[model samples]
Target: MNSAVTTLWEEAGFPEQTVIQRAVSDPLLAGQSVVGIAPTGSGKTLAYGIPVLTRLVPNLGPQLLIIVPAQELAIQIRDVLTPLAHRLNLGVLGLIGSANRQRQIDRLKGKPAVIVATLGRLADLIDERKLRLVDIKTVIVDEFDSFETEDITTIRHMRQDGLLAGANLGLFSATRNDDDIAAFREFWPDLQVFDEIKTDDTRGPVTHYLLDRQFEGKVQFLERLGREKHQRVFVFFNHKHIMQKVAGSLRFTHVPYSLLATDGRQVQRAEALGDFRRGRTNLLLTTDVAARGLDVADVTAVVNFELPNNITTYIHRTGRTGRMGESGTVYNMGNDHDLRDLRHLLGDSVTLVAEKPLVKKREQDDETNDENTPSTDSHDRARTRPASDKMPARKPTAAKSHNKRKQRWRNKKNVGKHW
Candidate 1:
C-alpha cells in the first residue's frame, strides 16, 4: 500500500481492510474486471482512483476513464480524486456536458492520467476519436446500474474498441442486485465477482414522509412547509406536463417558486440551479431532473409532487436531501392512485399525517417585481425528467407568461410597513 494513501485513509477515519481497499489492493484486479458493491459515501472513489492513478504513472495514456451517471457526481468524484491524484503529481481531467468540450479535447491531447465524465458525453468523445482509451489501464463505471438502458448497446461497442476487450473494468454502486451483476457479467462472463457492500445496511438519505392526500393538496402542503422553514425545497413530478401545470398553479396562487424544466437552455438550467444554491431562490419546483447528483446543500426538504416510477428513483430523489452529514425531509404527496402504487412497492405499514395549509404571502412590491421576472418554459425538463431518462419526440407550442402571479415570501419576523 502507498504510505501517503494509507496515511490519508487513516486521517479520514476509514477502517482498515475495508472492502474498497481490498478491491483496490488485490493483485489480480490490475487488469481484471469485477462488479463492486458498496454503500454510499463509503470511500469507493478512493478505492478505484488509487489503483487507476498508480497505473497512470510511467505509463503513457489516459490510464483511467471513469463514467459516472450524473454531471454532479462526476464533479464530486473529480473534486474528491483530483486532490488525491495531485498529491502524487498526477494529472486528472473532468469532461462533463455543462463544461466546454474544446478544453476537454485540448487536455485529452496532453494524455491526462485520468478522465472523469458522464457516459453520454464521454462516449460521444470516444466515438468522435477525441479521446482514445486504447491504453486505459482502468475503466470505472461509477453507477453502472443507472446507465441508460438504451445506451447499453453503445457501451458494449465502446468497450470492445476502447478496452480492446482486455482493460480492467470496475463497476460500483450503492445499491446493487444480482440481476444487474449477471447482466454486466454477460458483457465479460470471465470477469471476477465482488458481490458485497462493506456496510450490512445501505440506508438512504432523508426522512421519508409518505403523505396520503388529494393531488391538489400538495401545493398547500408545500406552501406550509415553505413558511414553517425558510429553506430550499425541491419539488419533483414524474411527468413534465404535470410539473408545468403545477408551476402554473403555483404562479396563479402567488406561490414563491421557480420552475426548472429540462426543455430550457443549458444556461437556464445552470442559472436556475445556481439561483437555488446561492440562496436567491428558496423554493424550487422541479421534477426528477434535479434529483440526481445535485449539490443543493441546504435543501431542507424534497417534495415529491408525484411518486417515482420505482423504488430506486425513490432512493435517489430522497438522496438529494440528506446529503453529506446533513439531515433533511422527503415529503411524498400523492392521490389515491399514488397511495396504491406506494402500497404495491413499500407495503402498507408507512403512516402519513395531514399537515395544515401553510401560506405566508409575499409583499406587494415583491409580487410586482416577481411579475417582471422572466417566465418559465412550460416544457421545462429540469422539473420533469432526470438527465439519464429520455423524453418522447414532440412538437413545440407558444410561450407562456413569465412573471405569473409570484408572491414574495419575505420573513414575517421582518415584515416592513410596505407589507
Candidate 2:
C-alpha cells in the first residue's frame, strides 16, 4: 500500500478497485505523462494519487499541483487527500476560487506539500509570485476535457510557463472527446493511453431512467424515492435558479435535502458538501459545477430535476451515482428535448419502455412551458414533430448530366478499373 493512503479509509467503505485500477499502475505510467479514460467512479484519483504522493516530498514549498474544475471539488479533494497527506505528514494547500483569500494566501506562504485549485486562480497567483511551479514535478489536470473550451487561454498560459519540461502531466476525464484529446498532443506528445474498463468489470454499463414529464413529476418521484431512504442521493439541475427552485420544492414536500448552489460564498458550498458527507442531509441538490470529482459514500441514486444541456454534462451528472462498483439509477426528466439528450448519454444503458409519456397538463404546461417557449401567433398553429426527427439532415442529390450518364455506362463494362 502507498504510505500516503490512510488506514481510516478502510472504514470509509473503499470499494475494491475495478478491473481498471488493477491494470492502471501498469509499467508505462510509473512516472510518465499520461491520459486516462475510464468509466465514472472508477477511482481515477487513486490511480494518479499513488504516483503523485509517492513522488512529491511532504511539508515542502508546494511540490504537487492538482487542478480541478470547481471550488466544491477542491474542498472535496482536500478532504480526501488531506488525511492521506496527514498519514504522510504532508501539508495540502488549496488555491480555489472560494473563501478566505488572505488565509489561502497565507497558506500558500507556508508552501504546503500539495496545491489543488482552479486554473484561473492558480495562474493569477503564479503571476503575482505568490506560488511557484518550478518545484512542481507532478502535475494533474482533472476533468481535462473541461479545460478544453472556456478555459483554453488560461491553461495554455500555464503550460507555456513551464509545464512541458519538468512536470509529469496527467489528464483525466469521463469524456474522451477526441478533439480535446487531440489538442493535448501539443502539450504532451508522449502521452500513453490505457482504458481498463472495457473488459474487466462484470457489472453492466450505466443504467439511465428517463421520466416522460415536464420535470415536475420527476421531482415528486424523487421525493418519493427519498421517502424510501435508500442512502446518499445526488440531485442535479441545469441552472442555479432551477437548482434552488427544486430545493425549495423538495423542502415543501418536507424531505430532508441539502442545496449546493454556485451563487453562494465558496465557504457555504464547502459546508453544504461537508454536511452531506456527515449524514446531516441525505438528499444533495446541486448544479453541474459540483457534479464531478465529488467522492461521497452510499450514493444510491442521482436525480436530474432538469436534464443536462449536453451529453458531457449528462455524463458528469449521472457519474455521481453508480461509482466504485456500486450500481445506482439516474432519473432524468423534462421536455421531449431533454429525453433526447438523455438518450444520447444513455446509449445502451437505459431501457426505453413504450409506456405513454407523462401527459402535459395543459394548464400546468401553460404555466411552465410558457416561460421557456417563445410566443407565436394564434392564427398559425405549431407543427409538432415526433421526438425521433432529430437526425442530421442529408444533402440533396443532384441529377446526373447526360454526359455523366453515358460515362457511367462506359464504367459499367469496366468495373474496378480507373482511368
Per-candidate alpha-carbon RMSD to the true structure: 15.7, 20.6
Candidate 2 pairs with clashing backbones? none
TM-scores for the candidates: 0.70, 0.75
> How far in Å is the alpha carbon of 246 misplaced in model 2?
2.2
lDDT of 1 by residue, 180-259 (tens): 66666667776666655534232334556667778577766765665564688888888888887766666655556666
Q: lDDT tens digits, residues 1-419, model 2? A: 45333342342345565555555554223667777777666777776765467566755677778889887777767767777676667788778776666788887877688889987788778778777777877777788877647575566556777643577677777767777666766776777766554664533334566677765777777677666744677888778877777776767666777778767876687778888888777788887776566777667777778776676777666776766567777667667876776677667755744333224478577767788887776333323545575455565456556667879898776654321
Candidate 2 worst ten-residue window by lDDT = 3-12
State the C-alpha lDDT per candidate: 0.66, 0.69
